[model samples]
Target: MSTSTIVPRAKATGHHILRIRGYSHTKAVVATGEHVVSCGFRVNGRTWRIKCYPNGSTMEHADWISVALIVEPEAAAAAPVNPWFSFSILDVDGKPVPEHTSTSYGIRGFTQPGCNYGWAFHRFVRRFDLESSAHLMNDGFAIRCDIKLMRAPSLRLEETFLDVPEPDLHAHLGLLLDTGEGADVEFKVGGETFAEHRCILAARSPVFKAELSSSTAGTCVKIDDMDATAFRALLRFIYTEALPETTVPAVARQLLAVADRYQVARLRSVCEDKLSGNLDKMTTERNANSPPVRAQPRGHHGTHRWFIIIFWFMELCLKFLNLLGLRRQPPRCSLHHSMMSTSVDKPHDDEARPLISVSTIVVSQRTGHHVLRIEGYARTKMMLANGQYVCSGEFQVGGHTWHLRYYPNGHRPETASYISMHVLSTSIGATEDAVHGKVKLSLPGPGGELVPLCTYHNNHGRCTFTKQDNAISFDRYVARDELEKSSYLKDDCFSVRCDLTVFVKEVRAVSLVEVPPPVLPHHLCQLLSSQERSDVFFKVGRKTFAAHRCVLAARSSVFKAELLGPMREHEASCIRIDDMDADVFRALLHFIYTDEMPTMTSEEATTMAQHLLVAADRYDMERLKLASEDKLCRHLDTTTAATTLALAEQHQCPQLKEAVFAFLCSSTANLRAVVATDGYEHLTSSCPSISKELVAKLAAAL
Candidate 1:
């Protein structure tokens, strides 16, 4: 025999991170009381300061170093802003200083002094520790401050009314190169003539600026030594940070060399990042019958200027293939139409280009369903791919890509009890304020009654996805026994519906095109409701409320026992209720119908709130009773306080009685008027247990 275990997940509210650049000092050497501060980087238009004190802020804590991140005092005092701030030091290699420590939450909205958070580490880095550390070099240091704004940021993106022309810098530069428009210089190389803009070249490259300044040649100049093909690639990079997506691998290294020679840091980093990724995957990227980019073993540098020149010519030949528009056509290389045919020695006319990596392959879905079926429960490998515990294949919604990851045997502390799932989004080049998403996981139930097992589908329950932490997961999802039931999993198959909404800076409407409308936006309660289609009826005296048995049963166990249980009423279509007035029962029916109590004021609740509270107690409706009591407490005054106090004493609602005692004895409560009410006579006669608490409150107020 085998036993199964399920894990529940808990939700971590917010996650945040920030990357700071341009640290001035490399080695920070400070005496006691001296501190170093960082320059500001803008996020949501707020300037932040990271102050690191080598000595403590106070003389008493002199043995410790203090670190703090402060908001501009002027900005913070204008209005209270709720933000979560975190600070960290950077090592010499530009990584956050790894201090496995808890963060200080600054959620209490900032006032006059402004919002700040930090630690005065009594056992912070010792003087000797900094003196011998590799990270603390040249007196230069960097720190990052990240804020998780618990409150939503403004997402106002005003669309333009005018037909504004786009700033197409690349297209304009390409045009200049092609048509020689405003061309100030000309070059001749490898039997070809090219016209170029001297100003653009001068601004982009110091080498070009220096050469043009020293040149005596007026409109035309002869060039040698530099490969013409390399020069074309270099010119393109000057205008665009990246090459075309189809740029062949053979050309990447040559492009890097040209970028290095021109001292173009942006282009150099792009090339290096691409090369590094490809180099890492060389061994595992291909197998037999699939020709791949072979990796040369790590060793001394090969003196190979000829290979760079040859590959540059090879990439130039690809331009002709692009002109033919033969993209994605399985490579049938042809040296016959080569632009730089003489640059490299070719034994034959064909050499296959590398296949595009699978990482670029994506599935685009404006609207669709992601179905997950867990089978062979004991045999299937539960571990998720890429180090995740559980994950689904990529899916798209609302113009964003997402992947769902779940943990069945919960991660870490949550193991053996809950199920956890998270949705991760692809990083885009925008500073979005927030991304709110609602998802529902369901189990296939009889007659379209999908048992919603896991959900975070409400305004309060919105899972915010941020660029800092692209995902959110539940650590305590649900109890183990619930999922193991036969009704929850019909032969081990569970499904989920993922819905997402994202707000970006340049907000363009994402056309959903031919997708069907999703039902999740309305929630299941909408369908189960509707007076026209209810299956069961609750009759109270002369009034009746139409209801669905499934919904009532799903929300309340009491209703489930009466309607779906083995009781005689389970077979009956109508249930007659008495001892409750029509208006009071109707209000109670609304709570049963929606599982959400109505909002009430003390005067408004007076009509049926007291009777409804009694009915709620009889039917074991705790939420409705609490809601009623809360509204009554808010309305507590001399006229109503005595009545409420009597009701609380009868029902044994300690909280309500405590609220009444505190209110009636205080200056705002008017205790003399409360004592004159009709219920006060019964309160003193039937409820003598409140005398002590009442006397204590009266004494404190006096």
Candidate 2:
């Protein structure tokens, strides 16, 4: 086994590099060309460097710099790993000419003066790999030793070659050009050949590069001398397109303009960045000042721009918001116009443009769905593209369009203007609100179900804002006009005015909605108060606790075991438990129903709520149990509280007791105070541990 070692050469300490005390005269060869030169390098911590001519082409006489090498300790411990090394040769002008190489170098783990050591020389050969072809041009050679002899794995040997191509000045300058269509050109690479096409095409396009005379054309800008390298850089942009970095801002802006005109998106992006950073003020300039406009970049698809790219991002945002049920639909206008003066002397002209307006309707239902209605508008009162007419028929909400058709009887429709002039002028929330109007329909009171607003409708044109609660009202003027405008509106917007200014404290169920004739269970009002019913439940399993009136029809032996009660009667008897959350057991007592358990702890209430849910569920009182479980679940941390409650609620005997203990032990203040304030007060004696905290919190709240 060939042993491997590292030899430290030198350490570059800022300026005066401290050379490794030993191995200063080690020999190295040019890895690129067959030019032999003196070794000038140092390896301090296995780092090695070879100094060479500034030109990097020929190293006939070169001063060596330092390079560092590092070898992994694991690799060193295993055995000597193969250490690949490289060096550089240079020409007299520091340009690469030809290269040389070494077959292999051996390293020993010697500790003293010289550790890394090994060498062999041979004629250099070009690798010409794709990566190399893209970045480097072969001209010379050099050699390096495996610094791994010092046991460093991360050893690197870099050959400093001379005569690297200088940045093309013309290419740098070409980045500033623009097309008449409001686009700019941007530079991607430093070479002249990369951007040639962009330069040539820009000059050739009718939208750019205007011609000028040699004499009186001093005032007119002309392309007198285009740099070949800049043109080449533009060509590169044309072929292997790319964006510009903001380093050369002016050039990048110009190049982007060129790219935009030629539909080179990649180049356009680079220019865009440069413009945003450097010439941002010009972003809003007119298209006539730049290049032919193309579609914006994919990044800007929903973005906004005046000429270059008009991104519909706002519309897209509105769409997303609509989907998420976020924003109210914006006031939509199909006809928008702007008047401009020609040097302040031109007459004002109404530049009306036809467009589409969509209205959104939010419906109250279990499922969240939106209706979009599109309406067309134009001052000309004529259908433009599609058969979109502003007729006198009632506008109905469609999938994504507002369908407006004229009534069968030919009549001049004034509803659209009236909607603009009057309907939109009022705010629905304020006295003058118009966006929304309400019509009061009297409903059932606590004792009686049906009531009518006959008096109120008769007394005032409409009900007071408070009396109309949540009902929709139309603009009386608009309603009347819409009715008159539409032979259809008489049927569509049909309504009979009613007035009931009586001081009725409560609403009754019968007046709520037209109900089918039936002797309902506790009146049809219960179904209407689903929200209230939901809030009254205790949750057990997927459903709510059985209703109080509901009786559990227990099936035999197995059911008794499931109920977990010593006395078969408690299991068998239909228990009329409170319609509260079972988690309430955690804070309050299920047995005490009259007074609110104010002193109960959140933990106790949670336990009580859960037990109540189990009792409600077992007894078939769904509403109470569901409400209890939901409240408990929402208030408590699911992990700690849910696990305990779930187990307690699962079993019967200790289910109530254990759930109560865990909840009482889990001291969350909010749950404690809620039980107190909601009139469940007797919990103070039951849950002594949290009585003080609950009292303080409830007192503070009050």
Candidate 3:
């Protein structure tokens, strides 16, 4: 019944602020439907911008000033990005003017490309209110846009003690035997008949198969000299591959005989093992109770009875051995003579004893942690009433779905004076099966570092979560007065990070070989650096580089065609590469040799990846091109998204194209910022069809 659960952790978030000077003049010039754009800023590794309409974005709300936050155009074409944001007007002291601030109703999702509008304050502040408010100081004011970007949940692997259920083939077969719905043969043993499937009996015993093949379906086979109970037990074993737990020594002996008669080797062996175990028990008891005798007792009836039992056991053992081809014939001596001879003969001292082998199973535990931060603390308290809680976006850890539940004013009235926080598992059937983990709650320090609040530890115990009781809570997480007076609360916001460690157990068998990591790349890199026996040279932009022709040919098809084909430049001592920088060519050669990209600064890496991608495409180096595309995707910003999209389109990289479009379409502000870039003009001119596609994607999203 055990199953795997994917628990998600809380999403990480980021924020930005935009300041506008000379607000009055800017407003006078930028009428309704017109806006002022802020410089592009980075948040959560993506580009974003803020647009402020002096009046309003549209004529409908011309009396009020409007503000909007946008993501990059390329971001719009991918999966939706939901970010929680708040717009606040800051006074000269840089404190928020509470009355003029607008926290988002909830998370806003930017899901379409070329979308210029996102979460905006359409009637943010009336012109009259702005003119009278002291927050607008000296014809200038600053706007803080606190944004919490919701990142996708990441997967974490954990080793747990929970065992997945094994297959139940025997149970299914047992059920079939009990139902007798498909029974084709009937066995009549001692006037008691048992109905069973001919195929099942045939599959279990070769003698039954031979006997049944000779008879027609619906035929009843008669058995002699066998108890009906033993026959029934035999039929059960044939289907289930196991004897009933309550089987006694008497029944075992009878079953063993019948099993041997029908050629059911495994059943015969099982019955033999059971009977032998009973024999050992009886012999041990008899030895403990009786006095030792030096000679055999010929007249005693008890001795005769024990001798007969031993002889019968030996005879069955001989038959089983003969069936298994281990013995060709049975011994000729009578049981009485054999027992008498064994009693007089000395016991063999060279008999081998059983051997025991010992090995250890290695059990290891893997633990991982996820941090959840709650922003707009003050606002959340005001918005949510008692007993109401807000949940952080779902995150994944150890392949399980989880979320943080924050009760600003406590979860119940009993603890209303305190803030309550709980970590809840959203995994299916979590209540039925418990997940074990620990939690540590903390507040942000002045340096944006974590300051310990309180930890809920089981202290050698597990904090178990199940579907019915899916949460581990700190009801008195923090006193409202203590938090308000503490330095942790600032800017009407506070963050709490939950360090969660899920415990999973893994068992691994000992391995003979301790394999080391591969070093081929390191060796190849050394070879490239040594450059010994180099046969080819390339000149690019006043710099020349040396390389091995075979290595280049092996890594690049274009190089193979140029170096080994009939049109090879045999006379030329060095090849001249055009339209490429010397450094870019050097990097390309390095990749060809080592299959690894050299490290560089973030800015330099982005620029180099673009150049290397083009070179990779030209040389038909798919891996290198894909690596470059992945790098570009991570570094995509408003300024470069349009150009990157054009590059993806031209290079026939569907993945990169999709990523760029997703970024661009994520928010209207993103699209506007990208459009304003010089790259956007180039994109429109070089790939006009892309603009139409963007429009179509946006239309569909709407």
Candidate 4:
């Protein structure tokens, strides 16, 4: 089976600060319905402005302050613009007042004559409240507008699952071996006879193939050297490509010898790994009781002839030292320069060389992230002096406890004008050893998604944390002036995310077999195309489809209930399905058979996905439903947005509904285009509450 993936759209973000000097004078001079507009600033290659009405933009809100964000007409006319924005009133310290901050929930569209698309908060703040608050400092205040613009969505490569069955060739072969239904040969060992197929044995071993090809069909071969139990294990490995878990180390040794004689390389390797592990365990125990051995420094080497002379001299010295009770244990030398030598003493017999086996070591890392939101940023800066820090609650990552240390006034006096951040490991016994990892720090975007800051100070490569250095520090994390002027410091708060990846090492036995890829899906697809042994038939529209009842039952609970449960039709030969197109039904059958989507053009796939989503939901196929939802999300356009929104609402798909809403609300042009389509009328009639929800979302965004 095959799979497909959907990529998310890219976004460009920027912010503008509007400082109104002499606020009191503007309130008195500007009349209601009139606004004082700031110079246009560009974001995503489009110009935008902030409009503030000291006496409110309309008569109804004359006693309240009004603020709005507008897209420039020239830029809007070039193409539809979708942007998400927020407005916050800044205090004397240049920090946003929490109660005066407003954010958009989703994207808003801007088109030609962008006046109608501008978003405004009619009653942003009461005139009396602004006049009395400290924010109205020196007869003036500032407003920060943060905007995030949405670009066209594009596809990215990702791994997605297909509903293909797992490979089972070994299972089938093992079953054949156990049943012995087509046995044409026999092997006698220790007066015990075993029946087996000649072809099966010949294919697994060249020795068996040579012997079997020269014998008759019903020949009985007698094994004199090998035991019956070891022979049985060899046959099992040949058929299953694996040994039984019940195979003991003693039995494994015997099997290893037999496998080697028959050239069963995989079986021999498995036995060797098992025996090596047992030997390592025994050696560890023996060494634990003996005196500790100190490792020698590297890069020391001598000629082979000189090495032999030194080796004997050292041996004699060690023996003399032992005799004098000056040493409790004899020294074992490791010759690394010219040859690979073990610490164990060498035996006199050349044939008794120690067995060596190598284990595979896999080095990897486990990564996780945590976000620390610093509320009341201004207050924290004032309260914490240089060298003082506030720590976030402990969060676990890579099986270790960690926390973020935030120094509002900086960790050192030299960096007092900037913020300091550090990630400290707090695991018990952490000081005893070093934990190696890479660290990255970032801030959350407008949508609450972490955006990596990639600066030299924020992203530190390969840090080793030990008792000497238990934390990784970003001394100049962010300049206070830069952060105070940025959109991130909203509601007097901002968040910092720490992503840590700790390295881990693992050792395991090497595997000899290179397993083949799965073919169950291919076989199932062939069966579906052939319509072999079909137990059920469906009549959809004017076309008929043949399918296996068992396959359908296994994939969908609804199909199971309809075909095998108490609700099943009695002796019904051909069940009729209505309100579905024949092509959709055929596509559905293909997915059910092979767990893959059929190839189709982009436009056709988009349309088919909608219908298939409905069919999938009806049959309670969640994966298919999700796949369809993802397809519709990626293909959302002006023409299909309204219809897809209505479908999402009707089908109880929250994610799809949200995607449609985000697409439609991104720009006023999108809303207008969608409303001009016939689907908009159907949406309003079928899902009347959606209009209210859309308005509510827009209000929340403002």
TM-score of each: 0.32, 0.18, 0.37, 0.38
Q: Write the per-residue lDDT of candidate 2 for residues 46-77, one digit (tens) a residue.
A: 22322322212225323323232323222224
TM-score between candidate 2 and the true structure: 0.18
- How much is 150 displaced in model 4, in angstroms? 17
The clash count for each model shown is 22, 211, 45, 9
lDDT per residue for candidate 3 within 1-702, as digits (tens), equals 011221111223444456667888888888898887654444444446678898898999999989998876543236667888888887877677788889888778887774364778998888888888787777777777777766653322111111122323345456656755435568889888787765446555778867877735347888888888898788878666778887888998898678779987767667766654454444444345433323333355344444445655665665676678875444443222233334322332322221111112332333555555555677888999888997665555554567788899899999999999888776526223766767778886756578777777677755777767878888899999998898877656676787776665454332212223333344445646765445678889899787655456556668877875577675677999889999999888877655677766556888998999899899998778888887887677887788789889999987678667666656678789999999999999999999999898777534
- Residue-level lDDT for 48 in candidate 1: 47
Q: Quantify all predictions' global Cα lDDT against the true fold.
A: 0.53, 0.30, 0.68, 0.70
Q: Where does the lowest 10-residue lDDT sum fall in candidate 2?
A: 393-402
Residue 699 lDDT, candidate 2, scale 0-100: 54
Q: Evaluated with lDDT, which candidate comes out highest?
A: 4
Q: What count of clashes does model 3 give?
A: 45
lDDT of 2 at 150: 34
Better of 1 and 3 by TM-score: 3
